[model samples]
Every structure is written in structure tokens, then in C-alpha cells.
Target: MISEEEQKKEGKNEKLLADLCECCIMLHVGFQVSPKKVTSVGVHHLLKVVLKKEESEETQEEVERAFLALKNIAMWVKIDKELHLSEIKEIIKYHQKHRNLTHLAYQYAWEFLIHRFYSNESLEIIIVNELHFGKEAARKLEELRKNVDWTRKEDERGKETKEVLVITGWMKTIKSYFDSCKLWNEEYVELIGSVVQIYRTAKDNYEEIRYWCVFSLRNAAGNGFVPVDDLLKSGAVGCVLEDIRKPTLIDEITHHSLTFFENISRRLKEKTYNEMEEAKRKELKRKVLEKIEEEGYEEIIISLHERLNTLKRKYFYGDELSLNISDYSVNI
Candidate 1:
């Protein structure tokens, strides 16, 4: 019963959809085969088409297809060995301009950037300029934190949980850049302070959030990036120590806390007496020991030592208990 003109219009629309799908498939194959050979022209053309869809009133199905295409292209570019920096910048630029995109689309764009350019110095500059260290990112984080209510059980499908997931994903991506090779610098102090504040305020039941905080702390503490004194001042060390001491702590949480402790202790141990004047070295060592004792590490170590001794005796003596405990206890 359709008119000829109406049928022609429908045919045109179907062809357009088919063409977009074909383009997406072709690009996916091209990138996988030879990413370096995939020129900007094809990418830009696809992006233009996608952006056009974004600006126009499109069907949800059409929009989703476009997003999928973009995500595939992004994944391809991310894995490319040649480092398509300009392509990454283009994606970020699109994200910055279209801040109203759906969470899934935005996450795709952000993931592309995080994977493609995290260790690149350009990322730091991009973060400072586009993300606005304190104003934009910090404000968003604080807003998300406030939205979460710790008194009630969290709904996995609720808005609060989704927001927390986004924040945690961002934290995990940022944590990777703070590894030993990178380290924390003075410029990042405010951002690091924000992370520490989040860690201190997060509820114990919110293990995902707490886990990333400790993960970031572990990286920040490594390679002597942040001085021991500064770390102590941030109260992160105390927070981690307290968490590890909890009777209900899980292995995953305990592992991260202990790793952070190990990083700090290993850094301190590297500063030999010959590296500094005797007075300064002794004072530094004394301060470290005092902090350890204050954090109850001394008791933990003593308990571990005693447990090891008991295990050694049981393993060696069977039930005899006659073997000299001194032989194993001396080294311990």
C-alpha cells in the first residue's frame, strides 16, 4: 500500500545504514591488518559521519551502531604500535566538545585515550588543560562521593553505583601512570592530596573504592616519588596501616596495604648511613622506626616471627618438641 516515493525514501535510508556498516567493517579490517597504513582520511570520514549522526535526530539503533563503530576504531588505534597520537587527540577533542554523550560512549572515548597515551607526557598536559585538575575532575569526584550513601546497601544497577564505577575506573587508569618510572611530582600534589582525602573518607564496606585508593598509594609510594615525610603528612600511611589491622580484612585489601608498606620501607632501607651525615642518617632511621612502631608494625612483625618459629618447630620436630628451637630461631 506504500506510495512509490515513500518506498524510494525508505530504500535510500536502508542503503545509508548499510553503507555505514560496511565502512565500519572495512575500517576494522584495515586497522587490524596494518594500523600504520590506515590513514587519517578514512578515520576522519567515519568520525564526520558519526558526528553528523550525533548532531541530528537519529534512531537509537543508528546511534548505537555509530558508537560501536567508533569504539572499534578506537580499540584498533589503541593497539597500534605506531602510536596514532593525532587520532587520540581527535578522539579526546570530540569527547571534550560533546560532554553530553551517554556514559557508555564517553567511557569508550576515555578508555581509548587512557590506553593510547597514558605514559605519554602529552597526557599530563592534556589532563591539566582539558580535565582542569582541581576544578573539573575534583568537583566531579566530590559530587560522586556525596551521592553515595554508606548507611544502606548499594544497588548495583542504581545511579550511585554507576557513578562510583566511573570514578573507580578513572582512578585505576590514573594509578597506572603513577608507577615507578613516572613517580609523583610537585605539580600533582593537589591531585594526590585529593586521592588521599578520598581514601581517608571512603567507608570500609566500599571495598572497590578503597582498593583503588590503596593501589594508587602503592604506586605513589614507590621509587621515592613522594618523600616519606610528605606521605606521613597526608595520613595515607596511617589509613592503610589501620585498614590492614582490621580483623575482617580480605586478602586483596591486605595485599595492597602490605605492598604500599613494602614500597615505603624498601625506599627507606635504600638510604644507607654512608649516603648522609651520621647525625642526619640516624635521625632519619629513628623517625622511620618510630613511625613503624606507632603504626603497630612492630607487634605484627613480632607475631609473624613467633608464628614462623611455631611452624618451624612443628615441621621439624613432628610431636617430639626435643629439637633445639635455637637452630631455626636464630635467623628468624
Candidate 2:
């Protein structure tokens, strides 16, 4: 298998260049590269070529054939599942660049599949693209968010409508929109503060409200409206506060997400500010090393080692240190 480093070395057009030919050998290799790694730009380029061909008797047949091949790649190989959320945003940017939304429906389909496979109650971090500036993306996301089903108890009186808590990528899209608006961040923070109050009040009485708090924490993490570290820590606190509710089977099941959130939350807190700062410094040094090579700089290999050793001594070992989690032991 070609390493990601090797693929990166070949430049970004790896799959697109490979897919242009009809030969089975090249096509087979392209398919083997995995849909997850198959850049969306590559897919869209192929789609454009097929769809825009000058009309001939065989044009429709050829386009259909190409579409089928790409479709098979998307479905059979689970490209969406392989793609990172950031990569999807990059794909969307590629489409926007070409003024093509022809495969947008496919993009949404992939996003949904990615969410379905990756999202669960326990996962704390959800990296989502902030689509505040794109009207089309906002509209599409609004349609998805509208499916939130909220209901109320018949016996409950003088209460506001309760909606099913939605855990989704769209909330981030909406929050990003608000953050981009003038005075919205101030309002957004106030709104979250109020919600935090509600969570505190309802902690004793309402299981549903507790659920909303958990959901909001995840949304806040995805939107980057709040530090992921803070939201996660709050989630751990929720496990302690909500433990008194004696949650039902369903609530118990849902609490798994809260627990996962708690785990990630604690992990982040364990990461000292000093450690992160030192790591960043080391990273900058590494980048400088790479830049030196890129510029074809001539330097003594021994001098390079000495310089690296000095930098490493200052930043490499401190109260601030890097982390590598090879395994996890969860005590439930």
C-alpha cells in the first residue's frame, strides 16, 4: 500500500490523474486507494468531465457508465466514513470553486453517513465545518435540523414546548452563523449561560433538561463557541450531578454519551497549559527544519543536530510535555 506520505509527495491530484484512463489496471489501482482518501475534488472533476461532454449518441451512455463507477466507489468502499469532517469541508470548497453543486446531494449523503458512524452519545469531540458564510449550506443544514421531534407530557401544565434533543453537525453550522453576526457571540454566550442555569435547576427534577445540557455541550464543542476542554469538564460534572436522578433504562443508555464526554473532558484537563505551549514550540522548530530543506539551504549535519539538541533541551522536557495514549482503561 502506498503510504499517505508517498501520496502527499505525488501532490494532491493523485486519484484524479489515475482515474482519467479507462484501463482496468489503473482503475483497479484507483479503486484500491480507498474512497476515504479519494479526494472529493477528484470525484467532482471526473463527474464534470462525464456530464459536460459534447452530445453524441454515445455521450449519455458514457456519462452513465462513469457515474456508476463513482457511485460504486462511494457506496462499496464507504468513502464518507473514511473522510474527516475537515476534508468534507475541503470537498465542498472544491465544488464551490468549480461552481458545481451537481453532486451536493451526494455530499450531504456522505456527511450524514459520516455522522451516523462517528457520532454517539459518549463521544465528546465532533469536528464540524463552520458554514456561516454559505447561504446554500445554511439552508441545507436548516432542513436537516428541522427534523428535531419535540413533545410534551399531557399532564404538565404552563410549560414551554419540549423538543427532542438533536445531537448533530447542523447546530454547529447555526452557531457559526450567529458567531459571524454582529453582537451574536455576546448573545450566544448569554444564551449558553442561561442554559447552564436551566441544567442546574432541572438537575433534580427533569431528566429531559439534563439530556439537553449534555447535547448542548457536544454542540458547543463542535461549534468551537466554547473551549472543548471546558465543555468536557462540565460533562464530567454532569455525571456527578445527574447521578441522583436514577435515570431509567433509556436515560441510562443515553448517559453513555455523557460518560464518554466526561472521559475526554478529564483528558483535556490533564493537559497542562505549559505542556501545550512547549509542544507548540517544538512543532514550530520542526517546521523550520522542513522549511530549511524546502529552501535548499546548505548546513552542516552536525550543526543541525546541535541546534536541535539545544531546542529540545529547553522545550522537550518540562511540566509541559507531549502525550501519546497507546491504551485506555475505563472503570465504569
Candidate 3:
């Protein structure tokens, strides 16, 4: 009994419902999180865009159903900072109280906590400021800080949280040391020293200390020419050098350093060769007539031709030579 327009509308409605359901299912299973959780455009706008073609009743029903489903389920991984901060706190408390701190939910909360803390400096500050005895998170954080030197009166009283904060801050700036050829070596060194010091002081668990040590080592190694020999002499590489020597520790440091050295050497050699080529290119013009007169141009040309053929055989083929423009020149 429906008209053509109505049937088309119904199809559109079905498609929209299917899409919304798909999105909701993805959200439930913990996937496809929006990059920036707090957008200028509200959730309502997102809903509008997603449900644009659906019938009002179908859209409304789907939205309500999805919301209800979410209400009953606990969020595992959330990109939404505002929702994440408090909801995860409540979840942690529940897990701790139930003596289920080792449960799936606990691990999930702890993982999210690490991710959320590392996600942004400002978020980290907010979470740290909100931490206290009443919230079981304070104890968890205290555990995380176990390797940090809390023996100092200031650290014990939480007055000197700056050391812990510095280690935390290094995560973001550490990457800059890798990409920039002119990156300050001192900054990288200081960061490594500070992070290691904090880890050692914290008396953190073996894993925590190991984690920071690796981070420090990786950041330091990323700088192509770290004063690694000097550090070894100073005993700074003592803890991690053994780790690096181990094959299972990962080859990233060695690989990164080798690649960096290779790139630098390649560029330097290329530059030197280019300068030599330019000088040769210039000399070839002046020497063209003189060399041809002294030595028959045909012989010179023949020799060059042979050299070019050799280069082609080596580089162009399976051999190791490379041909250049100068390799085939003649006086004429």
C-alpha cells in the first residue's frame, strides 16, 4: 500500500538504523573511538549526522536502545576524557572493594589509567591533583611511585612531586630527540639521567624500573651520536648495557643507531662525491681540447666508453659500479 516515495524512505530508514546499530556495537566491543572526544559539535550533532536518513520513530528507538545498552554496561576503553576520569575511578574502587583487583575489570581500569594519564599532560595533572587516600587510586599511584625516592621529607609529604612529574613529562618530548638531527644532546642526556634517577628512587617494582630504563635507553640511543662511550665510562650505562647486549631485549636501539649512521655517511659521501663531480665537470670543459691533442680524442673517448660500460655492468646489472655523465664524454 506504500507509495514509491514511502518505500524509498523506508529503505533509507533501514540503512540508517543499520548504521547506528553498527556504530553502537563497535562502541560496545571497544573500537573506533573518535580521536578527540570532546568536540565543539555536540553528541546530538553526531547523532543527527548519523541518523539523517532514518525515520524519526526508528531513529529515536535505536538511539534510546543504544543508550540503554550502554547504561547497563561498564566502559572498558574510553577516549572521552570527561567520561573516563570519574567512571574509571568508580570502577577501580568497585574492583578493589570486591577483592577483584586482579580481575579483568581491574586490569582494564589499570590499563586505561596508564593510557589516560599518558594521553595528555593536563589530564595527568588533573588526575594527580584529584588523587587521595579516600580513592584507592592514591594507593595504586603510591605503588607506582614505589621506585621514586619518597624517603625525603618533602617527597614523603608529597611536597616534591616534581621529580615524578618530570619523568612523566619526558614521554611526550622524547620523540623529538629521534626526528631532529640537530636535537640537543644535553636535553636527551639529562632526561635519561632524571628518568633513571626517579625510577631508582621510587623503588618501583622490577617491571616499572625496567620500563623506564628502556625508555631512557631508547631515547638516548635515538640520538645518532650519543656520548655512549663516555656514559659507559661514567657507569651510567651499567643497568641497561646488559639489557642491550641481550638479543631478546630487542634490536631497535642497534637498528636505529645503524640506520642513523648509515644515513649520515651516505649523505656525506654523496655530498663529497657531488663536489668532486662538479670540479671534474668543470675541468672536463677546459681539458677537452688539450687532452684530446695530447692524447688522441678517440683513445680518450674509447677509454671513457669502456669505463661507462664497466659502470653499467656493475651498477645497472649485478655488479657494484655506477655510471655518471662524465664517463662517456669526448673532445668533439
Off by over 4 Å in 2: 1-46, 49-140, 147-226, 229-246, 251-255, 268-332
**Can you rank all candidates by TM-score, best first?**
1, 2, 3
lDDT of candidates 1 onward, in order:
0.53, 0.38, 0.38
- List, residue by residue over 1-332, the lDDT tens digit for candidate 2: 33432356545553444345223223655455544445454454445544443445454445444444553444344444334435444444554455343322333323333333332311112222243233433344344335432333455533533222222333332333323222222334444444444455455444655555545543453333354334323333333334323434233323333333334333433433688765754553344334334433223222233333333344421122112221111111
Q: Which candidate, 1 or 3, has the higher TM-score?
A: 1
Q: Answer with 2 or 3, whichever has the higher TM-score.
A: 2
Q: Model 1, stretches more than 4 Å misplaced?
A: 1-110, 118-137, 154-160, 180-183, 224-226, 272-290, 301-332
Q: Which candidate model has the greater lDDT, 1 or 2? A: 1
RMSD versus native structure for model 1? 9.6
What TM-score fits each model? 0.61, 0.29, 0.28
Ten contiguous residues with the weakest lDDT in model 1: 323-332
Q: Write the per-residue lDDT of candidate 1 for residues 282-319, one digit (tens) a residue.
A: 56556656766776775654444434434434443112
Q: Please give the RMSD of candidate 3 to the true structure.
A: 20.7
**Clashes (N, CA, C under 3 Å) per candidate:** 0, 4, 12
Give the lDDT of residue 252 in candidate 1: 56
